[model samples]
Target: MDQRPAISASQAGDGVTLAASGNWTVTEAERLNGEIRQAARLPSGTRRVTIDLSGIDRFDTAGAWLIHRTARNMVNDGLEVVYTGIGPSREILIGEVEKSDRPPAEPRREAPFVTALVNDTGEAVIQSGRDLVQLSSLLGSTVLIMAGFLFRPWRMRLTSITYHLEYMGLRAVPIIALISFLIGGIVEQQGAYQLRYFGAEILSIDLAGILVLRELGVLLTSIMIAGRSGSAITAELGSMKMREEIDALRTLALDPVEVLIVPRLIALVIALPLLTFVANMSALAGAGLTAWIYIDVTPQTFLPYLQNAVALNTFLVGLIKAPFMALVIGMIACLEGMQVKGSAESLGRQTTAAVVKAIFMVIVLDGLFAMFFAAIDY
Candidate 1:
């Protein structure tokens, strides 16, 4: 009895018969594969094909699969295929292979451009609504926690708040001042260039003073904080979430929000107004220096014009917007951080989202404040 796998094909009355012999296990897989392929190539005009399996002394899944595949190929080529001498055991093995060899379903067609656009827009709107709800919930929770702390001042985390203030405020001042100064100088230069054409270059001081105090100072500071402090906050929170530290706090009966977020929020609210004040003064200094350099307008002449152009209300307006902008940045950063999943990629993505959302909300908030001030003639 040869143990090597073999197959032979013969013709009988307009049909073909395939006889398989020897071992059909994996040891003979290479020979069995060739034999199976040869057996599947039936003679032309053969209307029926039969695979005889009784001669096989040993069989396995590999052998069953080869037999099933040959039979399936013949059937696909429009021949009636039958199996002979396949005992109950081998029959079950072949049947399992057949069951697993189903054709793949057709692919779905892509939607039209307009339909895809509408679907995408709808999804974005839905996601935005969900974000709004989540943010509102967090805001409410934070407010309640703060309210409780008001009555129980001893419960407040002053050290944490002070630590955050040192980082988000005191450390942030130099960069904020540098950027504000450059922006102010640019504004003054451009204003003087335009006003010189109207023989009013001296008025550039007035323009810079009003713009810096009323708008540019707080807006630039907020944008910087959104990119710097807000991203840092998101990354910190996201890392904590990934490490399961947040969950650990929960298990210990501590509110993660009260313990982690309130201190940061309080620090932001306290620090932003001070930063805005620094930004305003820096910008004014830059503007005055640029005015003297570019337009030959000395501080002696620039001061009276600036004083006449911008009142106390102008300075107060930028300060008034700072705390609100700080709250928006802190809330967005914390929310994105809390939403982080358990991965480094999630932390990176959430940090980026926090910065973008905070900047967008800050600008929108500034516009709203502007409109409100105008309506109230403030």
Candidate 2:
């Protein structure tokens, strides 16, 4: 029996006729959900939707969610969404999620361009001041956590941290390396194309070298971590918060900040820089390959050029930025996770906010570094 969900679109009375029939699992439900969306958006006089799930023998949360997202998207476009003939099992799941006590989020406020600018500038200054003030607190907290871990290594979730690193650090390297390598390759290739005409192909080495060190290496590494580790950190703390583990730690007279936050934050602060250093290496290696392929610069000649173009200070300045970036990612994630209220929804929101804030901080720090290095002629 062909059990895939049905997707048929046609013109019905006043709106549209979008119908689907299937049990949606996490894997296949999304595909059917997409079908529903396409049918609902059909250019017809149909003023409403009639989703049929009668063919669906059994369904779960995934099915309910598929209906909700599709329905919500339709509602946002001033249309309605409903099931024409929901089966008994599917109806129960949808009823629970749809009728659940979910309060609407607070309405957002908009500001004019000038007001937004002024507000942002003020907020930036205030946040910068707050960051400076909090740095000392972070240092003290980190030291205390390290002391506790050193004294009671068993108390430190060593396996948990290792498992996390295996996923976030080791598993992520290939993707980062691929992207960094391609970025380096593309930059050199483009420069070679342009410079070949001007007889400046050699300059491409210095250009890619400095740019990779100063910008792409740190920025891409941080961004990757924000997506990978930052999200994981937020999710970890968020799950703990959701399950009342954070509160339980309080009940046990343990400071969640020192016990939970510090270890993860410190680990990130250490790991990110090392990961970025590897990213820089891969980027330059790829650049060397591109130089060879595009401009006939062999590895032997290119290695010396890269060496000459890069100095200890050049690498050191970028390394100096990593701890700060890692701190931003870790702190923002932990802080946001800690602030999540009593709900799974709030945890997801804070997790997303953590990633976004970390990425933003990474970029801002990059700009600051550029100015600082340029001013100092480093």
Candidate 3:
């Protein structure tokens, strides 16, 4: 016959003895739990509890847990609890359950508002420090790698550089030109409307020329490259890192920085200046067209005004910043790529971070350059 799970409690002189028996596997856990609960309601004046499990025929973790729980409850009720006649197998099971059963944890005390704020601020400061250190390290390593290539120019990956030049520069020309053209038209329209208030609508050519040449042209191109090519570089390197291809390169005694990063960096340095030049011309073309249509300013007149407004230095200033911005974008992208962990989610996060950081740094660098050039009277 299948013995029903049961627990019986009896009052002693100063304690209660709880006896448990019968099948106590998971199949009988429900009935066993009910009996355990019932046995926990000890008689009055019970100052101690004893559990006798010698009668159990089948015992598993579930059964042992019930027995352990009953004893714990009685102890919580200010009674000393002891187990007697526990069989060898059941004692081992009970021991395992006892190892896991722990008293409820105390509630955590909330920190003061000021304390939390200080802690968060400290963490942010530390994180920023770490990021700066990592970026500096990447820059140093890349410089060293470039030095190595200078000694062995034959080691430079021309094919890879050419591929990236085509991918990031040539293929990107249309969109770059298109966006620049549209922005130029908008600038000229706004400049003409605003300048007409002062009877200087013709100065719109100066406004369009100087702005596009000295700032907007290269700045917007850098931002586009950061968003497009920077993200692509980060995503590509991140995927390779995740798939152990980078590690494989290391095993082959090949430097990943040389094979992967240097070529991309070189390509960016070369491509960005050329792309910036193209964008500047496109933007000027657009502004010229806008001037001719909106204000009836002839291209002949507008060209002369642009030529008079902007000096060689104005164009040179923007072109000079292009390679520097490219270096920043490429380095930041490659840095973020190398930081990626072994997960698709990590790759996506690094790629996003690469784009955001590159754009922000580009703008910051532009502002610094503006200040420096203004100081130097460039």
Best by lDDT: 1
* lDDT (tens digit, per residue) of candidate 1 on 231-269: 999999999999999999999999999999999999999
lDDT for model 1? 0.93
Q: Write the per-residue lDDT of candidate 3 for residues 222-324, one digit (tens) a residue.
A: 9999999999999999999999999999999999988999899999999999999999999999999999999998888888888899999999999999999
Structure candidate 1, residue pairs in collision = none
The per-model lDDT (C-alpha) reads 0.93, 0.80, 0.91
Q: Give me the displacement of residue 376 in model 2, in angstroms.
A: 3.0
A best-first ranking of the candidates according to their lDDT comes to: 1, 3, 2
Off by over 4 Å in 2: 1-140, 147-161
Tell how far residue 196 is off in model 2, in angstroms: 2.9
> Stretches of candidate 1 above 4 Å error?
1-107
Q: Relative to the unseen true structure, what is the Cα RMSD of model 2? A: 15.6
Q: Which stretches of candidate 3 lie above 4 Å from their native place?
A: 1-31, 42-68, 83-122, 240-245, 342-349
**Cα lDDT for residue 137, candidate 1:** 96
Q: TM-score, each model?
A: 0.78, 0.62, 0.80
